[model samples]
Target: MTNPPEKTPENPWGPQNSSPEQPFGQQPVQGQPAADPYGQPQYGQPQQPAADPYGQPQYGQPQQPAADPYGQPQYGQPAAQDPNAMANPYAQQGNGQPGYGQMAYGPTPALTSWIKRVGSHLIDWAPITIINRITDPMIGGYDYASKTERVGTNPTLGFILLVVGFAWFIWNMVFKDGKTGVSLGRQVLGIQLVNADTGQPVGAGKAFLRQIAHILDTISCLIGYLFPLWDSRRQTFADKICNTLVIDTK
Candidate 1:
C-alpha cells in the first residue's frame, strides 16, 4: 500500500479541515454556528413571537370582559324593566268626567205659543157646541133661533147633554192624549201635551188631573187662560199645578 499523506501542523484532522473552497458536505467547526440548510434562523436570536393578531395578555393582569354589541343584559344579569303593566287610553280619567257621546244632564223642551193654544181650545169646543145646538129640539122641545137663547131651556135635557159632552171631553183628553199626546184640536193645531219633567207623553191619569185643575184656572176670571202670553215656559195656572207642558208637535 502507498503511504498516506502526512498530517499538517495547521490541521489537526488532516484532509478533513473544512475550508471555504470545499464548503459542501462539510462538518461544522467546534464553538461556531452551523450553516442553515433551509434558510431558517440560527440559534441566539429568538424569532420575535409571531406578531399577535389579537392583543397580547399582560402577565399578572386581570382580563377585561367583552363588550355587548346589542346592549342586552349579560347572560346571568337581571333585566332593566318589568315585563307586565301595559298601558290603556280610554279608561276613566280624573274626577269621573263623562265619556264620549254621553250626556251629563237631561234635555229641555220647547214650549207652545199662546195663539196656538187658544186656537186649539176653540176648535175643540166648537164641535161640542154645534152638536148641542143641533140635538136641542129632540131632547128638550125648546126652539130658539139663536144659540144664546138655547141655554137653560129644559134643564133635564140640558143636564143630560152636558153629562154626555163632559164624558166625551174626558175620553178625548185622557185616553187619546195619553196614547198620542194629542187631541183632535191639538193635533189640528200641530201641538202635543207632555209631562213637564220627563218630556214624554202625559198618561191618562195625569191628563185627568190636568183637566180637573182647569176648573181652578177658569175660576180665576180667565186669567189662567191668558197667563201663557208672558210665561217663560208657556205654562198657565193649570199647567203649573199638573206638571204638564203643551209643545208644538211640528
Candidate 2:
C-alpha cells in the first residue's frame, strides 16, 4: 500500500504570485494590465508625462530668454537719454565750417580794436619814415622836364638807403608776419593777423597780395581802413577780400 501525497493549499490571492513556473517574480494574468516595474500609472487611468531632467522647453516650442537684472533698453527699443544736457559755449556749429564770423578750428578770439591797429601801423612805418626824412637832404628830387634829377651831393648813398628801407618793410610786413602771424609792430601791440578760416598764419604769397589789396582801403576815402570802428567783425575791405582777421593776443 503506497502513502498518499498530502494536498497543497491553493493561493487565496490572484495568479500574480510566485509559483513553480514563475520562480523569480509574479506573472500578470492574461487580458489584464501588467504592474509597472517602476510604479507607473496602471491601466484604465490617465497617464502623467515624465518630468524633464534639464527643465528645458519641449520640442517645437520657442525658447524664452532669461530675465535681465538691470533695467536697460531691450532689442528694437529706443535708448534713454538725459533730458537736461548742458550746452557747451565754445562748441562749433554748422559742421565746423567757418562762416562769415566763425573760426574753422578754435573758438573765435577777441578782435583787435581800431586804435590798436593804428598804433601797430605807426610802429611798423616809423623806422622807414625816419630813415627817409634823414636822407631827404641828400637824395635827388624827381625832375619832370629835364629827366636829370640829382639835387643833393650824396644821391647814390641816399638811393641805397631808400632801397634798404623798402626791403626792410617787405621783410617785416610780408615774410615775417606771414610766417609767424605777427610782425614786429603787432608783437609789440600783442596782436596777430591770421586767416579767418584757419585761424593760422597766411603764407608769404597771400601776405604780399594782402598788401596790394590795401589799395581798396584807400580807394574809398580811407573808409575801408576805418571799417573796424563800426564793422561787426572789425574787418576792413582788404581784410574781407583777403579773409584775414586781426585778433588780440593779450
Candidate 3:
C-alpha cells in the first residue's frame, strides 16, 4: 500500500485534516481562521473590536421606567378614589325615588269658595229661624221686626228659646263640626273644616270657640264672610281667629 501523506508544522493533522466532516464545506487549518458557516465572522474572529465600550445603547443612559398600561395600582401605592360617588346617606336612591325623611312634591289642596261658604251658613241658620217662628205663638206671638226685639220683650219665653237654641247650636256646630269638621250644609256643599296647622278635625272645644268667634265676623260689616272670595286659605274672620281652614273635599 502507498504511504499516507506525512504531517507538517503548517498542517499539523496532515492533509487529511484539510477536509473536515462539516456539512457544507472543508475544515480550517490549525492556526488559520475558519470561514463562518453563515457567511459572517466566526466565534474567534477578533471579537468585533470590543463592541465600542461606550457606543449606541450606552450604560447609565436614562431609560424611562416601563409605563403602567392598565392603570393598575403600583406595588407600594394606594389606589385613587372615584370623585363622582354620592357622599350623602339620604340622597336619592338608585331607582330614582326619594330616600328617608325626604318629602315628595304633590299638588296643593283646593280651598272652599265664598259662594259655597255663604250657602252653608244660610243652611245652618235656617233651622234656628224656623224654630223661632214656630215658637212665636207660645211667647205671646207678637209680630216683632227682628229676633232680638222679640226676645227682649218675653223674658220667660226668651229663656226657654235660649236654652233650646244653645242645645241646637251645640248639636250642629260643636259635636257635628268637631267629629267630622263638617256641618250639614258643609257636607252638602262638599267642603270640610280642619285645624289650619294640623289638617284635621277641630275638637269640641275648638268648634265651640269657632262658633263663638262667628259673632266677630258678623259684626265686621259682614266683610268677614266676603273675605274667602280673595283669601288664600278661604278663611273668614272666624276661621282666622279659630285657626281653621275650609277646604273643598270634592
Best by TM-score: 2
- Candidate 1 clashes: the total is 0
Please provide, for model 3 over 61-83, each residue's C-alpha lDDT reduced to its tens digit, 9 standing for 90 to 100. Answer: 65434547886666677876658
Off by over 4 Å in 3: 1-106, 141-162
- Look at candidate 3 and tell me the lDDT of residue 100: 80
Better of 1 and 2 by lDDT: 2
RMSD after Cα superposition, model 2: 9.6
CA lDDT of 217 in candidate 1?
74
List ranges where model 1 is wrong by over 4 Å. Answer: 1-108, 141-167
Listed per candidate, the RMSD to the true structure in angstroms reads 17.1, 9.6, 13.5
Error of 3 at 85 (Å): 33
Question: Candidate 2, which ten residues in sequence have the lowest lDDT sum?
Answer: 14-23
Candidate 1 global TM-score: 0.49
For model 1, how does the per-residue alpha-carbon lDDT over 1-250 read when each residue is reduced to its tens digit? 9999997578534466556454545677767777567656667857443434686655555666565777677778775664675544545557786555444554454688999998988887776787687556545543455534334446676667768887778778788887778988899999999888777788898887887888977999989998898888889898999888999868
Local distance difference test scores for all models: 0.76, 0.84, 0.77
Residue-level lDDT of model 2, residues 158-223, one tens digit each, is: 888899899988999999999998989999999999999778899898888898999999999999
